[model samples]
Target: MTSVQQRTLYQWFEESALRQPDHPALEVGDEVLSFAGLRALAMTLAERIVHKHGRAPRRVALVASRTVAAYAGYLAAQRLGAGIVPLNPDHPDQRNLDIAQRAGVEVALVGGRSAGLFARLPERHRPTVLELDEDERADGPVPEGTPPAAYDLDGEAYLLFTSGSTGQPKGVPILHRHISPYLAHNITRYGITPGTRLSQVFGLTFDAHVFDLFATWGGGGTLVVPSATDLYSPVDFIVERRLTHWFSVPSVVREAQRLGNLPLGRAVTLRHSLFGAEPVTAQHVALWREVAPASQIHNVYGPTELAICCTNHRLTGPSARWPQYPGGTVPIGVMFPHMEGVLLGGDGLPADEGELCVRGPQRFDGYLDPRENAGRFLSYEDGGRAVAYDGSAPLTDRHWYRTGDRVRRVDGVMVHCGRLDQQVKVRGHRVEIGEVEAVLRRHPYVVDVAVAALPTDDGETELVAAYAGRAVDPAVFEAWLGDQVPLHMVPARIRRLDGLPLNDNGKTDRNALARILATREGS
Candidate 1:
């Protein structure tokens, strides 16, 4: 096998196809595609893209999800040496169009129910749309005179848009060089082999989906995609598919428990169970263990900027022996051996508990918009004061990407305290919303809880909590919370909800929760 450093992202899949042409590469909705079959489909689609655009495009928009076109289009873009921009079909039409325009997409490969989405885009804003049906057929063997592999390791592989604090989506372009090492590490770490079957739980827009596709394809593993119904009942889906690996946000566990589908030892086939994109609570780990007793459970952590994930903590011993943290959340563990991590306190000095800053091979260069780079990176001077990158100079490898997530070292392991933005000032005393949410989660009737700091009519900031589970007396819950936390930390109002709303990435949507709470406050 070629060293990962010597190959581009496309080479990962190409090499696997050559090694296991007949192996099942993807299983989506009653259709199974072999490595050879999927590779040929990607070649055919690449040829069509070049013919339509008169040359290899600079960027391609994959406006689809959970369909053949979505996976094939991704490979097709890599073959053409074009950076991919994955637009979600479920996203608002205007939002998709905005991302396409910002990415300078030359062509769009539409699939499933998203054909209408592309049609709705104004012609001027729309890229050259190629409507690919869900049942698009693959071509025969590769032709004699196929275009040579056009991608370079240093070139951008995929561009993703994440919500920015400035109200507009920020484009994060990850180069092939940045992701190759990540794929190499995780494929070996997770023991992905030709027979390994992994569940595809994340959407194309989420950065984690990159691991679902490339890592599995890179290792010749089979990717089994779940449908909407399948996601609602993951235990049954895992059992039916015989999946060996599973990865999704921690919220899915709550959903499975809510539906009463999490039976003990049902998903016996799983070997690796990974949860990320949000904190993993002890309750979540306990319930998942009941379902997959033999599986090696890990709590992985990373932001989109760090390539899929940079840190992980595997629960090795019995459930009773696992280390417990203050918030009942699993530790994020140490940074990957290859990366460097430092916690910077409020005074810009290293501390035991503060914002985490990291730098390594897997870290991206900078945001596509240079302006967004301001204050996102940090540089140390004389090993003393931490200086934030002001976007005045070129972003170098020496700069550490400020994660904006506060973390604390507990008994030599790093525990996620929550986002720095999650801390708010209430009556001149700083409060971390996660601490309150963690306390509320202890309530027997609370399946999930989200704490948001909102302004009252009196111009004072107060914590507002929204909880989901069985109905509980607000007075009783408040009394219970009062006993668990400081008086200022107790929520000014507690609201009951059927379920906490989730964003596109499946993380609890604190912004949306704030709006919901604000509406009640105004009432």
Candidate 2:
């Protein structure tokens, strides 16, 4: 039996491919790629890449998705020890080009009809583009010779760009060592096997896709890819494909419930259900459990810097009760066995309610830019006290990465509170934007909500709440909101919308909402 510490991600994928060469590895619609077939296709592409670039390219950008070539190109990059920079073809041309330039990519594999995406990039900033042919199936037999060891455990594996507070995209470089343990832990913990059919619904840019790709391939399970339409009606897709594993953000569950897609008592083949990337509320879990009663519900939590997820809280059975936290969300549970964690209050000491900090083998070294590392880590002293974080000194492995997420122990389990930055003062009273959002979401008529601090004409900050749900009079909702919370915590403004705007990664776009408020104020 393979242990969690035994192999790297690529090694595990190779072993799975070799062990089950004829098993189904990747699937989309009616198309399926056997392990042997996908490996052969990847090797052919790897050979072509070596021929063009002489040596393995340092980094490769993939402008494709929902195709065999995309997965093959990803494996090809791994075979060459090149880091991957995924460029979503559906995203704006400028965004894709920016990512390509920021990652310093040497080549980009344009899959399917996405070749035109690279043409928009200026000649000076563009990497060498290789477009995939219309037919992506492997035509030749498996390659004979074994590829050489080109990747180191410490080498960069992928570069993911997350939106920064400064309005620019920050690159998060994850190394091979940081990801191997994550993959191993998930595969073993989820009991993934050759028979397990996992869902791949997240976009390539979202960090959650990391679990979708490696966890399936590493455990020799089949990765079931869904079309854009499948996402709107995920329950149908899950039922049709008989998927054994389900993983996505809680928003998907809420969407399904809203659309009347989650029919009660509809049995599913899912054995493990996981949600991450946002707070998972008990209401969302109840909806999920009602649909898939046999599957174990788990709320996984982590940031991109800590790999796919650092902790998970599992509900044993459908009848099992869910524990609610202070923020009206599910408890995030304890840290994974391979990770270390601490919660530090504003005073820089360990506290029951504070910012969560972590340091372990799964933790990445630092951001791509040294400047972005400022105040992102903290030194710790005796008694697990976090010392001051010096922006002047270079960050080292000894420093704990500050996650910026506030958490508290609730009934012996760590529960997510909100982002530390979400705190804002109104009339000398501190209010958390997330707390307001959480409170509003509990309303029977409210489906989704977001609260932002917008400046008033009087040079003071006002709490503005935007929500999407059944139609109701604004005055009535405002009066009802006031009765539920303190006057200072109540929103000064309430705006109703058809739905909360979501970013490319599917999280609520608070910045976009703030812009709407600012536009209304100007008018």
Candidate 3:
């Protein structure tokens, strides 16, 4: 029923290369790499790596920006069966270096953009750096005794670090086994074909990038990457490239709508549109429908801990027909057939509203640090699932991962209620920041909004709202919002900007907003 039968990620690409060697695999601006071309380049780099190191290094780290070198380096490392640790060039140098050291990196594949940065690292801290050239070609025949492709589906594939609340980055190891089925399911579900053109909007650091890269390649489709300029004007980029599949964070939709760029009867080439990483509001979905009338829109949901997205709700028709969840966003829908999910209330028993617990074929085993597993999982035995998670209980593979996300089933569809930790005690009342943000986004002029419960130096927490749009009078907006919601729910401070700052993953930068608010308070 499906064309994708590869055991590993590299194998998927290799099969695509074999099936349609001349088919366009990657495109950025005028540059294009056919399946055969990309495979040849990656293999050539892998062969060179074997020659230099006598064998494949155990772990390879590379600056994971969206570039030809980054893509090639990833394939080369996979071809060598070496686990990859992608270093975010945009992240702080110390953080990247810390992750590199922590992951026990043996080699570094330096991209042209990050060569200088890697070059300046202290000698003791630096690994063996192999510079990758975008224009380099395979010079001669394969070197004698060139090592064979060694990737195993069960082995570690890549290491991704997510920002931790404790000021340290948490490392999550996504294995080939975890993602192989994920890629296959999406390729078939999304109806990807050789001629299908998908957008690559997420950076290498984010897990969504995994979907952008493999979903297209796995199904023998073309991957269209937009330049930084193109991202600011997504409608123009979508039209110019004639992208058939569009995927991005919901914020991009809001941004496009704010600029008045999403007019009706445009973006006709899009066949499947997917958005995740943040809540999708009704207004945003309506705007997207007008722009991409022919596309089937879906609001997918998952955490970085899970591979790509675990669940999605497809819009059957226009935005007005889209189901709205209690949190004021679209429903996230049911779990994929390959996974199982259970909701446990505060009492740790199955409830209509509770934290989501997931475990199945695609579920990740654990985090890099065993200690981080504390209280993050639920264990049960012999098919008897527990109603509540007991922190003192013993752990095993049978345990379900505590997603930390609260949700409820509305009309048999899962509706996200925001993160369990996102709930803040405001004046002894529990307030979900997501709830405030959702309501603010519904305002006529508010295109994008971010809410933060910033703590002042005096041990007081202030609810601050940062938004981007044409609503000039913050006082009027706040007063109107107060009339709509409870008094405590209204943001104490409103800061309006031309646009909300986005992090590398394209999510609204809450930390950046908190810092801006703190600075104004002279903290």
Candidate 4:
């Protein structure tokens, strides 16, 4: 009997393709890659990797350009029983190489623009690069000599890098078992079946990508990838692709609303839009309700460690915002079937406001590189005499991914308060205090930096960055950052502090930083 560990992702995908070869599996612009087409591409690539590299859990970093092609190479790596790492093309060239090296990446697959950057990395750290371009269009057969490593269900599927407050990137592992529940959960919750067509708008590295791919496959639905330009523009490809479901960060939907480009009523094919990756304000929900009255708008709430989503709040008529929201009905929603959500109090007991801890099938078991960094969790107990209790109750359910987020629990619904740590939510995206510091400290003029999240007057989110530098051209520094990071990652309010405020423990005091933001807003 081939052990479960021997059943690699490629083997699973190839089997799926053979089982339903004609099904439309991926749609990118006018190009559609069927299950069979994707399988063939992945298989040929996997065979090539095996024939050349003699694969043995070799880490393959994919610099995805075309969303569909990226997905293809990712699947190919999985088939080879190799670990897959997806790099953001937007990351600074040095930052990208640093991350890839940290993950022990031995081979890299990237697009044309990303190609030149990887070549600059030192030879010892640089991996064999695979470029995905129009030229790689030759569809070849999988050779008979290929040695496909047996898939291990217990083996890691991929590594997702998270910037912690320590100003370092940690790789989180997603095993096969961690990926399966998404398929099953969405299939039950979203009615995902092979007949459905789901929209993919968010980045592949984003938490939502797990559901974006698995839900479609689990329900036997087609996964559609929109063109990068069309996605950024005021365009809706739902009708063109005959997509029955859509899921993305609320920003994309908001963009459509701002541009008056939505076809909600006339293009009534969409069944739902699961919005996450940021907080959805009442105003954001109402806009969707105004347009997609027929299509369900679901609020998905979950951290990256929790797979993709652990709960949902389906949008109906804008419920009365409560003290928290307009009607207080703005909810993080109920926990998924297999999850337990506990809203703890400051003392670590059940408080209306405290840290939200999630435990269930979706919660990622552990990080590939574990950091016992005392930051991600809130071990209640205000520091007990026993030394184990942090003056809080011990979690009774299971191992909790102490989401350093502050939220108010209302009748079991978790309402986000902000952060339990310096981590801030800017424009609905989680911005680590450490990520900005990591970037800023790398600048030649910078001695140190402190990044914080501030609220804009429109009641929207923005970032407040504080840096200590040796007096360089301010405009030049700003311009340098603009070229390196995603536009959203840039801090809105830059305030240089003499030094980051540290607590007695020599750790950045997030509470103090939050006070700074509040004081700045007051002024």
Q: Which candidate is the best by lDDT?
A: 1
lDDT of 1 at 376: 90
Superposed by TM-score, candidate 4 places the C-alpha of residue 202 at a distance from the truth, in angstroms, of 1.5
In model 2, the Cα lDDT at residue 77 comes to: 90
TM-score of each: 0.82, 0.81, 0.79, 0.85
Following a full C-alpha superposition, what root-mean-square deviation does model 4 have from the true structure?
Answer: 4.9
Model 2: what TM-score? 0.81
Model 1 weakest lDDT span, ten residues long: 423-432
Q: What would the per-residue lDDT of candidate 2 be over residues 227-296, giving only the tens digit for each residue?
A: 9778778888888999999998776766666677777656469899998776677777887888888898
Better of 1 and 3 by TM-score: 1
Give each model's whole-structure lDDT.
0.84, 0.80, 0.77, 0.68
lDDT for position 342 in model 1: 92
Off by over 4 Å in 2: 1-6, 120-124, 143-149, 422-523
- Order candidates by lDDT, high to low: 1, 2, 3, 4
> Of the pair 1 and 4, which is ahead by TM-score?
4
The CA root-mean-square deviation of candidate 3, after full C-alpha superposition on the true structure, stands at 10.6
Best by TM-score: 4
Ranking by TM-score: 4, 1, 2, 3
Q: Runs in model 3 with CA error above 4 Å? A: 1-6, 118-125, 140-145, 381-395, 422-523
- Model 1, which residues run further than 4 Å from truth? 1-6, 116-125, 422-522
Q: In candidate 2, where is summed lDDT lowest over 10 consecutive residues?
A: 1-10
Candidate 3: 10-residue stretch with minimal lDDT: 380-389
